[model samples]
Target: PFFLYLPHTAVHLPLVPGKNFKGSSKGGAYGDWVQEIDWSMGELFKAIKAEGIDEHTLVLFTSDNGSAREKQGSNLPLRGRKGRTDEGGMRVPCIVRWPGRVPAGSSSRALTCTMDLLPTVAAISGGKVSKTPLIDGKNIWPILSGKSKDHPREAFFYYQMDQLQAIRSGDWKLFVAMDSKKRNWGNPEGKKALALYNLAKDIHEDNNLAAENPGIVKQLLAHAENAREDLGDVGRPGKGQRKAGWVKKASPRLLSR
Candidate 1:
C-alpha cells in the first residue's frame, strides 16, 4: 500500500563508523562501515517483519556505482573503477526480495540498469508513467519474477557525465573513441575509435574484438546514434531530453534567534 525509498550514505566517503561498530570489523574502517550497513539492513527488515509487511514489501538493494579506487574497495574481475565507463564503473549488483514474488536464492545474468527501476515499480503498483517525455525504462517484473527469460531491454547506453561513452547490446560492449582527458583511472589511455569486447567470454574486457567483428561494431554504432538522438551526447541536445528543474530564487536556511 505504500512505497519507501531508502538511500543510505553509509560505506561512502569519510567512512565514519558508529562507536559501537568502530572496532567490530577486521577490514579496518571500511569493513566497520560495511558492518554498520549490514546492521542497518537487519534493523530495517526487523521493522518490516514487526509491521507484518514483509510478505508484500519488495526490497531492492543496489549501489549507484562500483567501489571508489581511492578507498579500500574492490571491483575485482571487472575492468574499471568508479568514474570510468568500464564494466566495473557501470555494472553493479542488484538484489530484489519480495517473498513469494521473486525467486529465492536465484540469480540473473540479464543486462539491466537503474533506469529500469521506474517502469518496473510502476508496473508492480499498477501506476502509469508519463509518455510525453518518453521514459527509457522497461518493465522487468517478469524477468525478476522468473516468469520470462527474454531480456526486455534491447540496448543500454553508457554515459560519462554528458558524454556518450559506450553501448552494450547483449554480450557485446563497445567503447567509443574518447579524448584522453575524459578518460579515468581505469581507462587511462582512452579507448580507440571502436574498442569492442565480448563480455560473455572476456568479462575483464581485456580482448578487443572490434577489429574482427566489424559488422557488430556497425550495428552497435547505429544503436549509439539512436541513443544520442534520444538521450543526447556532449554538445548535442536530444529532442527527447526534457528541461531540468530549476529555481529562480534560492536562500539558505538560518536558525531563528
Candidate 2:
C-alpha cells in the first residue's frame, strides 16, 4: 500500500497466464495477460479508494522499458522491438493518476526515464540526503505539478552496458552501437552497424539514416560522447556495469566474441 511496484513479470518470459486468468480476453494470450495486469491494478486503485486516500495518493504506472515488440509482442506503429534502441524498447508506457492533484486523462511527452523517480519521491516526502549522491536523476517536481512540461536535466543517457548507447538531447536521440572485438553489437550481421532514428519522423525506425545523414551522425556522436564514457565495451568482457550470469565464465566466442 505504501510502496507498490506492480511490475508484470509474466510479460517478460514464458508468457504463461495463471489458471485464474487463463483465457479471459478477446485479444488472445497477450491480451489475457494484459487484462491480468490491468485487473491487479484495479485492485490497487480500489484499495486506495477504500482507505479514503485516493485524493492524497499518487499512482504512477509505467513499464520498465519498451516492449520487445519485435518478439511478436506488438510494437505496432512504433518501430523496432525490445532489446534495441528502437522506440519500443525505450519508449515505455506510463500514467500518473492523482485525484485533485493531476488533471484527469492528460498526457505529458516530456521525455522521462526511470532514474528520475528517486529524487522525485525524496522531494515529495521532504527527504534528507546527507551522503548518497543523486546519481542519474533529479526532483522533477515541476513536471508533476503541471508547472513545467520539459525535462529538468540538460541531457539524459540510456546505457545498455556496452551493447549500445543512447543519448537524448531535446527531441533528437542518438544511438551508437558498441562493438566488442570479442562480440560486437551488430556482429550477427558481421560488420553490421548501429542505426540512428529520428524518432520524430521515423518513429518506426524503418529507415537507416546513418549513412544518408552523416552530418546528423556527427552531431549525435558529439552529444553522445558524454554517455559513452560510462558505457563499457559490450564485445569486451568485464566492462558491463553488472555482469550477466552467462557472461561470467563464458569463452570469448561464447561471451562477447
Candidate 3:
C-alpha cells in the first residue's frame, strides 16, 4: 500500500563520515563513506523486517550514475569516470530484492539502465503503461521474476548534457563523440577519437578494437544513428523526437474591481 523512495547522498562529494566511522576503512574517507552506506542499508532492511511485510515488499537499490572521479573515489577497472561516455561513467551497481518472487542468491549480466525502472514498476503494480508518453523504459519483470534470463533492452545510449556520446550494443561499446576531458583525464590521444571496446573481455576498456572490427563498428554506428534520429542529439536533429509536455503560461487579464 506504500512506496518508498530513499535517495542517499553519502557516497558523493565531500566524503565525510560520522566520527565513529572515521578510521574504519582502508580506502580513507571514501572507504569510510562506503561502509557507512552499507550500515544504512542494513538498518533499512531491519526496518523492512519489522514492518511484517518484508515478504511482500520489493526493494531496488542503484546509483543514478557512475562514481565521481572529481572526488577521490574508485570506479576501478572501469575506463572512464563520471561525465564521460564510458563504462565507468554509466555502468553502475544495482541490486533488487523481491522475496518469494526473485530467486535468492542469483545474478544476471543483462544490460539494464535506470530508465527501465518506470516500466518495470508499472508492470509490477499492474498499471497502464501505454498511457505514459515519451518513455524509453522497458519492463524487465520477466528477468526479475526468473521467467526469463534475457533482457528486452537492445542497446543503451549515453548522453552527457544534449550530446550523444556513446552507445553499447550487446557486449561492444562504441564511442561516436569524444571525451572532452580525455586530456586531463589521462588519455590525450583519445580525445574526440572514435573508440570501441569489447566490454565483456576488456572490462577496463584498455583495448580499442574499433580499427580491427569495422563490421561491428558499422553495426553499432547504425544503432547510434537510429537513436540520434529518435532522441535528437547534438549534431543530428531527430525527426521522431517526442515533443516536450511543457504547459504554456497564460498572461493575466486586467479586470475592473
Candidate 4:
C-alpha cells in the first residue's frame, strides 16, 4: 500500500508547508502544494525501488477527493468544485501499477470507484470483508486484470453532503440534487427529482435523456434504492422516500412501451 493520504491544507487552510518540499510544482502556492503531493509519489516510489519491494508490490495512487477552486486549483471540464454535489467534487483520479500481476501500458474503463476499493483490496489480499454497513462495493479484480472489457457496475452513484442522490447507470446518469438549481434557499429542497445524461456520448453530462429513455431511468431508480442503503452517506438511510423532491411519484416512461 504505497498509500499516501494526508490533509494537504492551505488548499483548505491559512499558511503552512511541511518544511520539506519548499518549491515543487509549476503552479504556485497551490501548484507547489499539489506538486508536493505528486513529488511525494516520486519519493515513495524511489524508496520502493531502493528496497526492491516495488516488483512484489501493487502501488495504487489517487486523490482524496477533488481539488479546490478557491485555492486556484482546477478540475477542468468537470462542472462544480470540491464540497459540492457536482462531478468536479466527487470525480477523482486513480492509478494502480503492479509489474507482473497487472498488465502494463494499458487502460481499462471499468467504471470502478472509491466505493469499490474495500472489496478490491479484500480480493487482492484474500482477506474477509467486515460485512460492515453501507458496503456497496464489489471486487473489480477481473476488470483490472484486463479480462472483461465491460464494467461490472451497472451504475455509478453520487450523494452530495448526503443530500443529493444521483446515479449514472450505463451511459446515462441521473442527478437528484436536493438543493434546487433555482437556489431558493430553505434548508435546501428536500425533494425528489432527476437530471439525466448519456455518459458514453456526453461524459460532461451536458445533456439530459430521462424524457427520452424512460426504461433505463426506471431500472436505475430501482438500483438507487439499494445503492442508497449500501452507500449510506451523511448518516442517511436507504429506506422510505427519496430525498430529492423534483421527480416524486413519477414512473419512468420507457421507450420500449
Reference-based TM-score, model 3: 0.85
Instruction: Show the colliding residue pairs in model 4.
Output: 171-199, 191-244, 191-245, 192-244, 192-245, 192-246, 192-247, 193-247
User: How many clashing residue pairs appear in each of the predictions shown?
Assistant: 0, 7, 0, 8
Query: For candidate 1, lDDT tens digit of each residue in 54-123?
Result: 9999999999998877465788899888887889987899999999999999888888878899999999
Better of 1 and 3 by lDDT: 1
Clashing pairs in 2: 66-89, 68-82, 79-204, 180-235, 182-256, 182-257, 183-256
Q: What is the lDDT of residue 212 in candidate 3?
A: 100
Tens digit per residue, CA lDDT, model 3, 19-82:
9899898888888988888899999899989989899899998997677763567688886777
> Using lDDT as the measure, what is the rank order of every candidate, best first?
1, 3, 4, 2
lDDT of 4 at 146: 77
By TM-score, who's the top model here? 1
TM-score of 2: 0.77
Scanning candidate 4 in windows of ten residues, the lowest lDDT window is: 177-186
Q: CA shift at 6, candidate 1, in angstroms?
A: 1.2
**Candidate 1 colliding pairs:** none
Candidate 4 lDDT, 1-257, residue by residue in tens: 44444444554554344566555556666666666677667987899899888888777776666775656678767776776555777777778888887789878756778778788888888787776444667888787777777877777776654543687766667875343432212345455457777766776667877888888878887877777665464456756334455875888876873
lDDT of 2 by residue, 1-257 (tens): 37766666867676776678878976567667887888888998899899999898988888766665444367668765566555766687768888777778777767677777887877888884444332567677678778789768666666553544566666666666644322224444334466766767877767767888788778777766544445443444332244345655765555565
TM-score of each: 0.92, 0.77, 0.85, 0.75
